[model samples]
Target: MAKSATLYRMATDEHICPFGLKSKDLLKRKGYELDDNLLTSREETDAFKNKHDVKTTPQTFIDNERIGGYDELRSYFNKSEAGQQGTTYTPVLAIFAVTLLMAFAFSYASNFALLSLNTAELFVALTMGVLAIQKLRDLFSFTNSFITYDLLAMKVVRYAYVYPFLEAFVSIGMIAALPAYTVAPISLFIGGVGAVSVIKAVYIDKRELKCACVGGDSNVPLGFVSLTENLFMIGAGVWMFIK
Candidate 1:
């Protein structure tokens, strides 16, 4: 027990260089102060990282709480009511889900949710009207992103979106009762097109293109980050159809 306590304290004394604001902020926010734990040596910190699965040296460990990575930290922070309630997109997400449900109904049953074709068409038109309003709301909600400074200092794209715009059309087509010949070929073509656009942007433009899909960031240029984000998005759209 004595050795364990000694090793833990020593490991946290900043590790390798004994610097960086992350460690300072972690300690100060807990009200413990730094000198309380700064005397521990560097060798022990490296040893602790090896002994445990920890990749970070100045990370927090409160009680038996999880020593988390990025994803875990996100889940923890966003799980609180304070974290969840402050979003301007709740209503939008609800409407989007409703739209998806309507789409799914139209796709699977060949009729929009228990209604006759003519009747369903009218209802669907009304739903699309609602969706148009939601889209405007979504644009407004994300408008402030233009001025926000990302800690990652992510770059914006200069030119792109010719392909993803097409893919978005195909994704809509996939859930509709378009001619089978038209449906399969167009979807595959759109997916291939999006893939090419992403690769070219990443390898050539070399900046992350933001407006390709999520219109959130003002269309960033093609780059590693943009390529990664686009691939993930395309992957997500593909994964929706395990059926």
Candidate 2:
């Protein structure tokens, strides 16, 4: 006989528990015959919670054993919590994807051209802005990770804190089509230093480490992607100087 499970979850008109849906999907995927008990009103949800002596909804039971919530169910099945740990390119890929779309959108809106030099420039600038925003979200955390591999950050700790702001400034200046004199120097300096740091840490020393490109808490590995980011800034700086 197929395994059987019971799930009590919230499904109200005003609010639906996302975790509840996740639990239901997981049970179905795991080949469990699920008894999906929906608590459709606040009173019903509260009653269910009170009766079970649980603090939250989306409770599950497998073979009559209580499996607390969505996270608990995942743990019971020996599944890793989503995006909680491990090396991932998700953040970086997401930034790139969004910036690419923005570049195309802006280019088309302004000049009716989807592909142009301006599009390329916009893509790079927007990427810098987004990446800088991620770092700025938690400057302390970002600097802690950045100092591990960045030579400038190690020698002058304050530089790590200033780095994200510099990126944001350059991004804005480039997008605004400001004179190269104002932005190119900063871009060149940061990008040059970043490229050297990444090379020494990853290529020369061969030390495996996480990147602060996305943020301090991120699991993005330090290597090619990081190097490419620096190279992009360098190229943009040079382009600005020439154009």
Candidate 3:
């Protein structure tokens, strides 16, 4: 006889549990014939939970053995664990990946080509726009993180709040084909300030701190990546002015 599994999950008009779907898919992929039970109402769901002595939906049982929740099932199958949230470069990587694609699309649309120097400019502007959005998501948290290592932000606390807006302004202006003479100087000033702060904090001060590059929620260490972002901005500004 083939091995079989039983799953009790929540399914309703208002809410179809995502974890339930994942658990079902996992069982299917593992070749288990599932006897799926949907708890469709609040009363039914609560009664089911009480009967099983379980606090959550999406419980799985295989071969008369309880397998707990999705994470537990993954453990049973020796799969990489999921839903462990931590500080990661995921935000920055995602931003750059999307910006790269957008830059390519813009280039192809304008010049019928996928690559050009103009694409680099577009990439910088798009990247700045994305980073600005991240910072603006939780301005207070971002400001708190920014002041930790940023020299200007330490001396002038308002700079932390202004930084995102300034980044957005220069990036949007560049994207709009505004006069380089106007926005380029602003970029240079901000970039120079940022680079110096990062250098002093990481190299000179040797303070281990989180980067505010992708906002306060990021775990990216304050170092080379932070320095590189500032350098890119400075380089972009110079390129716009000269070429």
Candidate 4:
């Protein structure tokens, strides 16, 4: 939201954000000139919100003016006079599926695995499930220091692109190398991934987003933090795939 508005302020280019990326691509496929801010700069973030005094998540602004939320964005797509240029939030559905899949899959897998230590191999699937959801969500900002306005776009990009991959690799390594189920790397990764997915998905959906990773969020895509939080786990999935 902030990224899109900031781009609007600087240029006519409209950026699509599925929560951040999924939604971003969804918009571009509909023909909007869009940029992916999955690695947005702090300046862009602050300036966008400060320019419009946005108080809520997924807020939309047009031509340096406050336009409102998802409904307004929908109107914009509809070509209403009150709306600005808009794009379809379809990618949000894909993202939603990924998130919800991990949420339910890993959650159940973990609960069942609790029955036996020998079943710890199940953790690999569970952790990878969480990783998939998080990557789709892309909430990797928490992987490093608090992102500040002082950080350059290059810095943000480095963090966004590299951190999740590393986190995922680490999770995979632990899973492959650690041999003890009692605290085996596999079980730990699965536990970490499942716990984080459900907690973040539920809390963020509860407090700021009405949609819980399904098309429902097209009405209001998941926020950056939620997406970023999931990104690490998503990267973990990538690692699992490679391993």
| TM-score per candidate, chains pooled | 0.27, 0.80, 0.91, 0.25
Write the candidate numbers in order of decreasing lDDT: 2, 3, 4, 1
What is residue 234's positional error in candidate 4, in angstroms? 15
> What is the alpha-carbon lDDT of model 2 when measured against the actual structure?
0.94
Q: Which pairs clash in model 2?
A: none
Q: lDDT score, residue 205, model 4?
A: 39
> How does residue 36 of candidate 1 score in lDDT?
29
Worst 10 residues of 1 by lDDT: 1-10
lDDT for 227 (candidate 4): 50
Q: Which scores higher on TM-score, 2 or 4?
A: 2
Q: Which candidate is the best by TM-score?
A: 3
Comparing 1 with 4 on lDDT, the higher-scoring candidate is: 4
Steric collisions counted per model? 11, 0, 0, 17
Candidate 3 backbone overlaps, count: 0
Better of 2 and 3 by lDDT: 2
Clashing pairs in 3: none
Question: Model 2: what TM-score?
Answer: 0.80
Candidate 4 Cα outliers beyond 4 Å, as residue runs: 1-114, 118-121, 129-155, 179-243
**Overall local distance difference test of candidate 4:** 0.42
Candidate topping lDDT: 2
